[model samples]
Target chain A: MAKTKARVKVPKSIKKGEVFQVKTLISHKMETGQRKNKKTGKKISRMIINKLVCQYNGKEVFASDWHPAISANPYMAFYVKADASGSLDFTWTDDEGKSVKKSAKITVAG
Target chain B: MIHKTLETRQVGRRELMAMFGAGVVAAMGVGMTPRDAMADAKSVTDAMMKVVGDNKPATGKIKLDLPQIAENGNTVPIAVEVDSPMSDADHVKALHLWADKNPRPEVASFRFSPASGKAKVSTRVRLSKTQNIVAVAEMSDGKFYMAKSEIKVTIGGCGG
Candidate 1:
């Protein structure tokens, strides 16, 4: 069994209708199947974050599917328009059939 | 292969201040003197050539933004902006970022569509040492644009 970890961080409060930046980074080796194990002399099976999806208040804000070329410890940042106070959910899935999820809540002030 | 040209077009204080304006240049937080920055630029350029292949002339136009001196190398702020409207008729196809001297040369590559609205991206990256950062932007019309800058890393970043 493999252990996977993910963390999500966002401001506790935000102004409604104002645009704010969101940053995310997941801890993973992102092994590209191309590498070979020195001891076994066999190609190491790929273990990577195949997909990342972010939803704000049940509406999709951003999503991306990664490839072997992506570097280790992938970090992503983007802007989100805060329409109303809501929860932001982040989900990441790997090719190995494993998925990790985390979320953050933001309060929109008038 | 086009990275050589990028190495030559080093963004000096005068040039950088010209493109981004004095406000941006000031925000960069450069601690080193002009002489030191120039020396670091040369070394960083040499390091980039080692990883990007032989004699490839990287072009200009890709806009790269980084702090002149980073207090922490573990989380250095980075931004890449390209001059593309990102419309159906014309758009930025892809943007690639490379740290001249990180353990891994290629940091990240973003593929965009007309729906992206803008060809700009901001993120944080880890720098192992003082080095030059390079960004290459590819347009839908099959043209390449690039930008580079020297960043002084006070402390070694990358969990070493």
Candidate 2:
């Protein structure tokens, strides 16, 4: 099995109802189904990070559907409004049903 | 180091496609099949319909950033930005991207809420050949906006 790691960056605290940026990057090869192993001479099956979803305070703030066309080690950035103090969850799902999850805390300053 | 590895891999992919008699596809000129291009167009149309229903996406508001020419098809950098206030009253809800020539038309999508301060995303995608990259942004009021850019790819991004 291939190793995976997910990274997220968000502000420690934000004003209530303020929109802030969220950045995410994942480590994955994103092997497209077109390559072949040099030694075995067989096609390497395609395995890529297919989807990403981000939730803030249990509400879906951002989501993405990715294809093999996306480069390896995907990086995406978006903005979100900070409604209340809560955890921002990031989940990445791959082609094989494998998922990597990470979260960061966001505190809304009154 | 990354460029070196990608160069080698691109060469390998090109050679493999040649071995499989797909060299003609590389020379897309007059030899390219109309049916293939039609299929590609259909997929992109379906993807657009899925997002905006029957509504026609108006131009402007969305900007597509991509290289005018890409030496490598495996990794083409792209960015989509929508001009919006991103407030609770009016914000971008979702963004969808498509490649008009790849085996699969849908490239990537992004969903956003008002909490997100802006509507912009940057990523790298594979292009099968010289084709246009289309992006559609769905707004809070159920309106769709679109933008596209043409990019030339030397080698196919998806498996030829």
lDDT (0 to 1) per candidate = 0.64, 0.77
TM-score of chain B of each: 0.64, 0.72
Best by DockQ: 2
Error of 1 at A51 (Å): 6.4
Clashing pairs in 2: A79-B116, A80-B115, A80-B116, A81-B115, A81-B116
**What are the models' TM-scores?**
0.52, 0.75
Clashing pairs in model 1?
A: B1-B56, B2-B57, B2-B58, B5-B57, B5-B58
**Model 1 over residues B82-152: C-alpha lDDT tens digits?**
87766668987666566777754545556565544556667667677898887766577656566878999
Q: Quick one: best TM-score, which candidate?
A: 2
Best by lDDT: 2
- List residue ranges in candidate 1 displaced over 4 A: A1-75, A79-110, B1-58
